[model samples]
Target chain A: MNFPELMGLAFVGLFLGLMLGSAFYYRNRPAPFVRQIPAFGRVRRAIGLAVEAGSRLHLSLGRGNLISTRSAVAFVGLSILDRIARSAAASDRPPVATSGESTLAILSQDTLHDASKFMGADYDPLRGQLTGLTPFSYAAGAASLIHDEATGASLLLGSFGSEVALITEAGDRTESLTLAGTDNLTGQAVLYATAQEPLIGEETYAGGAYMGAGGMHQASLIAQDIFRWVIILALLVGAVLKLVGVL
Target chain B: MKFPFSVAVAIGIGLITLAGYFLNIPVLQTLRMALIEWATTLAAVALLVGIANLFTIHWNKLTSGKVGGLYSAILIVSLVLTLGVVGWFGPTHTYSKWIFNNVQLPVEGSLLALLAVILVVAGVRLLRLRSSMLSIIFIITAMVILLATGPLFGISVPGLTELRSWIAQVPAMAGARGLLLGIGLGIVAAGLRVLIGSDRPYRG
Candidate 1:
């Protein structure tokens, strides 16, 4: 292979390794997945039903700053958008995406456009709006729009702190089908979300596959699982060796 | 007009952000510097807004003599004093550093230490919370990362540094890159979506 090809292969290998590791870590806790499955199923059903009902789906990228790891998690949410947009395209409706950061605002817009284009559907990017930058302001804004009866389904994914509760509560109040995820450990926020069975920690990584992106994502997730076990074994060995004074 | 304005701003910023990926670009570098300057100004405004919000919330609470009124009063006092001192003398001044080192650092450190304790306790008790193979892997990897990252592991051990370096450089970096690519794609898509008017986040 050429140098670039070699580097590409190496990078792919590393990505797969990390994904396997994460997947393994996630498999340890099945309760969240078990809880998320039915919710996603409901969302899928809602989306299908909404297409017939002429309702739009809502997706939020959260209020995470660009420098944060949560912003990185927002990519997973975008992957979901890719799927949601495609599904919406096949149907009569389109999904609405909202983001807190300027960067994410642009991304949400692009994702919607491209997903539609790739699916051979017509989509106008001007429809996507840039919400407020402040967490509370963004939440309140999103809450107001989503309260509209036309919004049939809601997905809250990405980096969020205590604001998760406010947004999720809004969705709940509207009785919109919602699937939420965040890695933030703020107590009340987490309690509010978990009560609704939101995906936690690494499970947020599964956003792509859950949205039907492709098998490669699932493959990456599986790879993450395997690497996670490898790390565990290494840790156990290291601990045992330390105990025995073999080092 | 609103969506178009936001989309135009987004496309301009996105290009600059992408250009920032490369270490060298005079225009991009200038733009970044300008952006930072603007951001610093905006941040100052945000700080003012936050203070206003705090006072509004607290003053109402104090007038109503709510349960958290005293806490708000204490907060206002502390915030005013700290801001006063820092504004009078720069943050790097001896008195400022003293306050930071003695008061702020300790409080923050104690809070972090408390979190560490809670995490460890929760980790132990919740070890069996999820018995799935994936959960085992996650817990195990987390423990390894935690131990390896801690000073208790003793960096003097042979191969320890190498292993840590390898894990960070190879696996972590790779995963981070893939994630970055995925994020880049999503960002591009979102921007286009906004430009085309498919998703409306600006409407309240």
Candidate 2:
């Protein structure tokens, strides 16, 4: 292997090791305190409101191909959806999911099914829908559903683009609580202008950890902190090395 | 200890894929390609299933006489007709191209135009609704981008172009890169969780 590729492999190996170690160590220990994030607070409130009002909670999983760069964000969306589904499983109107990708839609149904089964509620595959394939089409279909379905709260997470404005506007038209985030920069910018709670950047990925999915989720946060500092150090060193013509 | 069949399969394939990407083994490469092909095929079938679900939804709405049933019926008709044309005449045929050009393109283009308006409206509403420091900054940045890109009355303000380029290439790029780094780390952590079976999302 070449030097750069070797370095890449080493970095990935270290990352994997750190993550696995931290997750294991933290799993047996008391859960660490997670800092308060207002978005997560709003999500908790939305869950309660949905259950009490019998209004549907909606999750808009963006159009991300499953085996691609965007899949991680979509997976995070699934984690959030899993928690939401479990919470709303016994309610009169359980949470619903909409996706632009077929694979995500199928997985969403499976997640909902698992949640409902564990909660002793009947699973309705119809709740997890593949709304549209294209960006604008997905936004249109999801937006109309937001307006028509009596959605109490809408969580827009995954990979989206500037077309997210349509979904956010629809949520606003219904006076629903809309928390949105995406891996795309344009989507984040639009969401900042539109969503009630805009999850910027890594916040979307932090959904599972903040929602208390498990110890592993929390542990991932710990690993992330360490890795972040390491990156900062590397950046500084690299800058110094470049200045000295040593890099 | 035994895992559920689906979970085992998921973990096995995941490991193979990860190994294939990192390791320099011919066998691993072949295995990875095969695994990815299988996954793609599954995804394609899932698309068809998704379409069936979509049809089922609209069909139910039409049958039950729900609100906007007519729209549902129209959607169903368009979907079926388009599928028939594409399947019968082949995707590369003139009819398929005609349908895409005449139908889907206009609709998508209209939506794109609508999105532009919606973004601007949202930005305006944000200023009115929130009126916070962030919103103010957002508007200012947006103004800079717009003004720099399209000079007002074709008048180029001195240094405005350079200032916009600096804002874009420096501060904006830095912030974006930082976010990307965090996102990358988050992806790794999430993937690890799945690989280790710490989270069994596929579990029934």
Writing each residue's lDDT as its tens digit, candidate 1 over A112-138 gives 887777788888663344444556545
Candidate 2 lDDT score relative to the true structure: 0.87
Candidate 1 CAPRI grade: incorrect
For residues A59-132, could you state the per-residue lDDT of candidate 2 as single tens digits? 98999898887878888888889999999887898999998999889888998998888899999899999888
Among these predictions, the greatest lDDT belongs to 2
lDDT of 1 by residue, B40-102 (tens): 576456545545544554566568886656765875686678788899999989888887888
Candidate 1 has a TM-score of 0.50
DockQ of 2: 0.72
Clashing pairs in 2: none
